[model samples]
Target chain A: MPLPGPLQDLVAEFQRLPGIGHKSAQRLGLHLMAQPVEAIERLASVLVSARRALSRCSVCHDLADGAICRICADPARDGGLLAVVSGTREVLALERTREFKGRYHVLGGLLSPLDGIGPEQLNIRTLLERLRDPALREVLLALEPTVEGEATTLYLSRLLVPMGLTCTRLASGLSAGAELDIVDEVTLARAFEGRRPIA
Target chain B: MLGGNAQGKTNLLEAVATLATAQPPFARKDAEVVRFGAKDAIIRSSLRRGGYPLRADLCFRTQGRRAAQIDGVPCRRMVDWLGKVTVVLFSRADLDLIQGSPQGRRQMLDRIIRQMAPLFHDEEARWSRLLVQRNALIRHILTGAATASQLEAWDEPFAVAAAAVSRRRAALVRSLAPRAERWLEVLSGGCEALGIGYKPGIPGGDESMSIEGPEFVASVLEALGKSRAQDLARGHATVGPHRDDWLARLDGRDAAGFASTGQRRSIVLALKLAERDLLREAVGEPPLLLLDDVLAELDPSRQEALLEAIGDGVQTFVTSTHLSDLHGAWRARADICQVAPGHIARPSVT
Candidate 1:
């Protein structure tokens, strides 16, 4: 049976979100309706406040509750080194490694021409502005090895290399402890192409 | 290769085709290509490519994509596994090239192109991806979730991919047309004329536009822009190379409209031969031809013509139910293997 007006409206709103189809939206709507009115109000307030409070970092463009993100504000992190990434998620992923002493510069997205994303659409200008800092000695491009990531890396390389910056891309290949046979072909092939001679 | 009806001759061909195309030719289910009792199957073959003997190993699991290796090195993609072991297969169903829908002819041409140039697989895959992404963007626009600017941003890359696919297909058809005509003359003993034309679905209907240059991309971009309203209405791309096709003419006449069965067979055979010659010329080696019980379908004279054309040094495997059906001349020099229920009796090569 068709849902009542307000329930249908809630389901429609849910359906607008990515990956939530009509059935899932309807289920979510019915489930939420069974909750207390205070519970729904609390959920709405939390979502609204979180979205309104979180803004981009002034320095690295990572998600920030204030003008500058925690990483940029941290004095222990190396200021001379910058790891360029495509999104805030990548910043979180790199932070989880616990090995990266440097700060991050998230461009928000890779250069995907097919998706209408180019240099202008990304935070490339801020990236260029950040590169002017003399303390920033080395730059590491921590982007995915996808076609868009490669294109963005190359574009950054052309812009930065002439300025005598030491720009490096992420090392792509089979991970440590991964089985040789189980490694994907693209990764294996990349490992071959990126092979270096050991002294 | 000699085998009776329901024997394992066709299965052998299907395995090789699967290895070359990354898709099984005759089976629907993924596991159907595997042996009836086996959990997995391994096809190991060694052939010389680019003047070096390369060994290819293909492993097909009951589920999941097949893995392929060339010279003990894994292929980066299934396309890399192609062009290593090329094949020219002509079966009874090949007559459908003329009679069937445009998709059949497109697929036949694409198969040959994919085998000859492995990167064609990459371009075709890219085109498919762009098409899907573009359609999704259009759907978003239709639903008011996105704006037209997003679709505009996607149009450039989509147009580039569409242009790339159409250009390669046009070039393939262009090269094959004359060769197919020449082969037709040779197959029909200089009496029949064949004409092959690429029918790309360019917006302005200028197939000649896609044949060359940067202008193809511009035209495709314009076409995509022009069809934006239609695409928005339909929630998909209304213009692209995915709907491309080629036409075959017999004796300077439209083969699809007026050709008889015998004429259709001759044209299809000629196209297959043209494909073989094109591969040979490009690769510097003739592809292995697999004739899977098609000799029995051809009349005696046409069969004689085909056998004569397939003459000499080219590696060929002709399957038949009886030895008498095969030419005596071929039998004198041929190493015939009789395929029975469970085994094939190996013949001693002269």
Candidate 2:
């Protein structure tokens, strides 16, 4: 069956979406046709508005309509404590904890050598630049504790420790409330190594 | 076109995705998805929700079986079966779930919403339709046939739809926060504070996720007015939830960058368990947990912990290349089945 001119183009476009198929494209086309003119008009308006409005923050690459993201904009954040993360979303995750009263540096990604994500591809330079701020105290390497994260952290620590910044890492071990025997060896080792002084 | 070694895994996954999303998975005319030297292929999958089962059967010639059924009854169109069954897949590629490209995370977030709220899939489709029109309008303007002044005409709808997507994701994440945190605690053993945050393309400027309904629409409109010129030169629009992502920070650090391999797996597992919890809370029941080759990746202890977390209630389908890896604990709870080249059998497990 031949679809009408505009409808055929619409179907083609619909098929380009994350998971829509040709049949779905037709259903959507028919659904669009069934809608009130205002609905169509309203949808069209929203699509344009969303595209035009959002921007990435200059400092963090986080979605921002302003010059800086809310986290970057907030004055209360401890400028001294920098939690290095991979992307804007992780920045949001830290913010939700309300536990970390520190500023963050979004790395944009981890160091994946196989996929060609190296130190240069990530925001390592920017992180180094962030250290220039005199108020900076600790550069908490907040990346995932993967080999890449470890490589990045080790790489950063080599640079950061010499710079005299208090380089700390998030503790790793068997999770609380989980069985000890089921914990992986590496985690078990980390648990023993990072064991704190008995209060 | 799919010829790489890793590509086969991706292709198989895509085929399943194509089936799940395409309403009548078998009705499509094109069936060249199989690899070379394979005489034929048969894809049989069932979509079930709320105990309602709809089956999709696709047979190929160069590719063999093509048929579909809803409730065991024959069906003609794929659309009839879509949105009836939903699956959420988080692969190793999801390492970027926190740290990689915004586009990757955006798709992940949308997938969560797409599963929970089917209408979101439709609304997103509608939004995409408008995006194409706006892009076409821009293309026309670039060619001097249309004026840039007309850009505002499209920005209005763009903002509204984008705002709707942002609000839905925000609300969904917000609603799921407690569960996410709880699951994180159980998975991580409460050592680190678990946090989940939503970075909206356009911030509502309020902390409690206040952006909802027309207010979000209004704010989005205001934003579109702000970024109009940048959109024209780029040949595409920037900003919005399409560009936003969820960030996970574990104990004041980036979960992706700071998390170890085992930690990343733990976090991802936590996320999966969180989704299970979220579904159970949002709806009254849990979706079947399909553990595909995940046990091999986990150590014996983590494996036991994982099984413990899943419990016995939720229906789970686990697959492994070897049975020894899954020995003890879960073996009894799971119905054992075996699969080999062109064969499947139920082997007794003592």
Candidate 3:
């Protein structure tokens, strides 16, 4: 009762997913095997096409089938108000909010000193080059509000300030409808320090 | 809250997890749980020995057809099946646990406890409901529809539930302290001392005045009466465990305000490891450990600590772009998966 080599590999592949266990992997493998050959071929084709067709966007390092992603190609976007992000998914995330009308520069990742992701590892050079274009004015950083994010923000501020572009980090404080008293001291302090008077 | 990047990884995890977690920092309600593309999403996980089957079915419509099922059976009540399955999810955003807000730390504590003690979840749910009702009553008082007298009536239930919550949190924090300190020492090489304390609003540590369901209610009522004007103006309950906080100290200094980024991350790792051990102690088995690209964020020493924590084979899931970021020990025990675009493959096995 030996399983086929391809089937065994497929089971092993399914086991690697986030929540799928060995039992679930076996079940998925069986289900895939039970599928019509055409469906299995279609799944394989879709995967291959996606891998072959999609690549990093030339300007922003986001996923794109062309040299430039649609966001970069869109002339309506305000390049001056560029939003610097960490991934292609982030670009789409901001777009879904429908609030940002600016172009983007995806850093691919933040500066994690422990992981050897220094300033050189990110697309900081390209980001600086984008800022130097004169059309870029404000660079909104929408990276996750983590320590690495803070490091990235500090690095960008130093790089962009000399170039005279205004740098901004996404506000990190209490969530909407949350109480001030319940919030931690650091968040409360940040809220106070970062507060602006109502005009 | 489902699609590409906003794929609701954190949100979904939170939604399912809240049932097992007590007095979470998020402090959200069931109504607030549904958003954008979902009408009502039900999370039904079964707790089993070692591993159990889980099914989460959302009852909604595309054109106009509503349906729900779990393991192929029509889902009746989502809560009925909770604690039936053990779930562990990993996401890149979990780096926040190591480098983000105190809310994350508090949540880590609550979630671990919820998985261990189901009664804590019930207590939290009841307390949350009471808090909301009390807040609404305060809003009414602001509008003159309710009086200060109304606050006394609500205080009984609010205080009773809030006391239960405060006691549980304080007890849990006490339990986690030793494990947390040990983990911090291992990760940071004795460079820092990590200590976490529950800062419940009530100061009465006396055994006689300690806490009981009725006494808690009466005490809360008195506090509400005292803060009536303030609560009315704010349109929310002002004095309760709902407004409590967890204080994290690194060498006796507030970790959030004073600790360096590296120090904060070390403390966070200590807290999570403490959670793993605490959950195992409570449940007689370790919960599934999820390391979402966090190995890359840790220093080599911290990475070793992480490897040791996750190496117990209590079932772990880790995601990383670079395979080399994984410690050699973890890689030895791990089954690697490569994810790109729409395809996920096991290239190593192939």
lDDT of each: 0.80, 0.67, 0.66
Q: Which one wins on DockQ?
A: 1
DockQ class, candidate 3: incorrect
TM-score of chain A of each: 0.91, 0.73, 0.83
Best by TM-score, which number? Answer: 1
lDDT of 1 by residue, B1-350 (tens): 77768888887777667666776766656788788888888888877766788788888789777788888999767856776777888876687889798777777877788777666777787788778767766766676656776565467777877887888889999998898899889877898778888877766554355457887788788888899888888878878887788888777788988988888888888888888899889877888888877777677777777777877878887877777776666677678787778667888232
DockQ of each: 0.06, 0.01, 0.01
TM-score for each of the candidates? 0.68, 0.54, 0.52
Question: Across all candidates, what is each one's fraction of true contacts kept?
Answer: 0.00, 0.00, 0.00
Model 3: CA > 4 A from native = A1-199, B1-48, B51-79, B87-102, B202-219, B341-343, B347-350
Local accuracy of candidate 3 as per-residue lDDT tens digits, B64-99: 333445566874433333444343433445455544
lDDT of 1 at B182: 93
- Identify the CAPRI category of the predicted complex in candidate 1: incorrect
Instruction: Score candidate 3 by DockQ.
Output: 0.01
Ranking by TM-score: 1, 2, 3
TM-score of chain A of 1: 0.91
lDDT of 1 by residue, A1-199 (tens): 7789989889999999988988999999999999999999999999999999999999989999999999999999999999999998898899898999999898989766457565677898998988999998899988886545655776677788999999887888879999988875556766886899999
How well does candidate 2 match the true structure in TM-score terms?
0.54
Candidate 3: Cα lDDT at A160 = 74
